[model samples]
Target: MKEGSRLLDEMNDRSREVFRRVVEAYIESGEPVGSRTLTRTLSEKVSAATIRNVMQDLEFLGLLDSPHVSAGRIPTQLGLRMFVDGLLEVRDLDHHDREKLDATLGAGAGDVGGLLDRVGAALSGVTHGASLVLTPKHEAPMKHIEFVSLGHDRALVVLVFADGHVENRLFAPPPGQTPSSMREAANFLNAMIEGKTLSELRRDMAREIAARRQELNSLAAEMIETGMAMWEGEADNSARLIVRGRANLLGGEAEAEELDRIRTLFDDLERKRDIAEFLQLAETGEGVRIFIGSENKLFSLSGSSLVVSPYMNADRKIIGAVGVIGPTRLNYGRIVPIVDYTAQLVGKLIAERSER
Candidate 1:
């Protein structure tokens, strides 16, 4: 009869305890929990008949449901939401989990790109769900540079950053350009970018090239200038996304309808538009956030849940997010702390990188 949050407040203490026990048991086994089962689990000395009466009252309140007349009851989506928003007891992240995250993410701290992949892997491992890691734009010192010819006067500039990020930029070659000249230009520009970022090179590029004009022919110089000019101006603000452990979403105990929902969820994951929307969810508001089933607009039909926390930089600006994706029936009490701790570690990593 009462609304979600208020229902907990209005519920009699015995009724509330019985409802909580039912939701916990159902979440543990994904089965309808009988009042007899609650009688065993509840610390209070309650009789099975009394618990059954409470369950009936709960079902009447729209917080619980029974699949059959004599079978046990399960919490509805609204019921689960109410529990998560109120009754769930989330623990602090344990020391072992903190160390594991450090070891996993810090495997190769210098390789920021590889670290992003590991972040996804660690999140999936910890939360038992598909992980979506949204990485910020790649802007780091140059590690290596190469120019590959794509024919038809088109060439590809493959850039390897010091922080393990690799990017490809396309450019058209100038007239009279040959393989030898392109190689010569690559060697010359590579030397100029050893400790400099793309932005720095763009700023002092003309002067640097003018000084080395005698080393390269007119055509090679023109080619190098054209290639470098393409990378000038602001770096692309587009976030690079990493998706891992999608297979983990499969092979769970599910009915035909639930199986269909999982398939629909996979289909949504493969869609660019849906993925973009999912990423936007991580950027919404702050702290650790949870979206259960239909509350998540992108995968509403799939009946999926997302537990995410945004990681920020030294400036407290949210740089990215680390989170998990799974079915609606997940262990929120356990996963919340893991996600929150991981996000904090990621934020610290971002801060460390900025200082370097």
Candidate 2:
């Protein structure tokens, strides 16, 4: 297929008008749009035959396709891309949309996890499509570390971040360890491991303990290693996947085989690891990324569409992503701006949370 940018440039005034009308009609009705409908609705002074000829040219350009020989042409993936990139005029969030978004964002504070869950649910409700929110990767520098004795051989290691985020990990103390040893180990780590990444602290602590065998008691060194191991495990499991509105996919008209494929897609999404990988790709991208049919291997069977945008922190570093997934017939002109706006809103919320 030709690049959407080149195809958009090649379209003349009359052809562009016909193409826009057909794309708009198809998006609204989710059906093939005939030239007659364009003639009736468009304000342009053009006959049905003229519109038909232009649509034929657009079909040759791979922007339009006819599902049936007798039916009119509908916008293809390329057509949607061209319209979204060149023709679609994104409007400001309307009063209703702004009010709904504000209400959703205002419902919670302090708990980032709860705020993200509500954001995903609100997005799904507004878009009528599946919504996804990938949790921010923890990159805060360590401020302090402490190991508190909980019970028999099990201790709770509290990690305080420079951003005021505190996470606790439960760990079993190494063999032949006591609460006094654990306390000593905690003091040693708090003195040496402050303002370092978990990985950095782990590597440095390992080297120090290995080099100085006789400098400290064996039990104290073992307790320190145990606490470091717990922090590493928690960091590995920190990224979360939030998905909502799987039921909305079933409401559309699709063949049984297609429905089965969609079910499989949902199953794949349920695996948090895979979803995290997918969202990670978008998180590193420059801006909103659109994946059309057959563009990604995961959704090839379902021929689904994904519109994603990364949400950033106060420093403009991408911390997460928010997006919608639906069938190829999704309204890109409408949904693209919605996703973009929502991403910005998510970024703002994250920045505020980080400041706190």
Give the top-scoring candidate (lDDT).
1
Off by over 4 Å in 2: 140-237, 284-287
In order, candidate lDDTs are 0.79, 0.78
Clashes of each: 0, 0
Q: TM-score for candidate 1, please give it.
A: 0.71
Tens digit of lDDT per residue, candidate 2, span 135-220? 77666778887778877767787888888988876667776778788787877777777778766777888888888867877788
Q: Which residue pairs clash within candidate 1? A: none
How do all models score by TM-score? 0.71, 0.72
Clashes of 1: 0
Deviation of model 2 at 350, angstroms: 2.5
Question: Candidate 2, overall lDDT?
Answer: 0.78
Off by over 4 Å in 1: 138-237
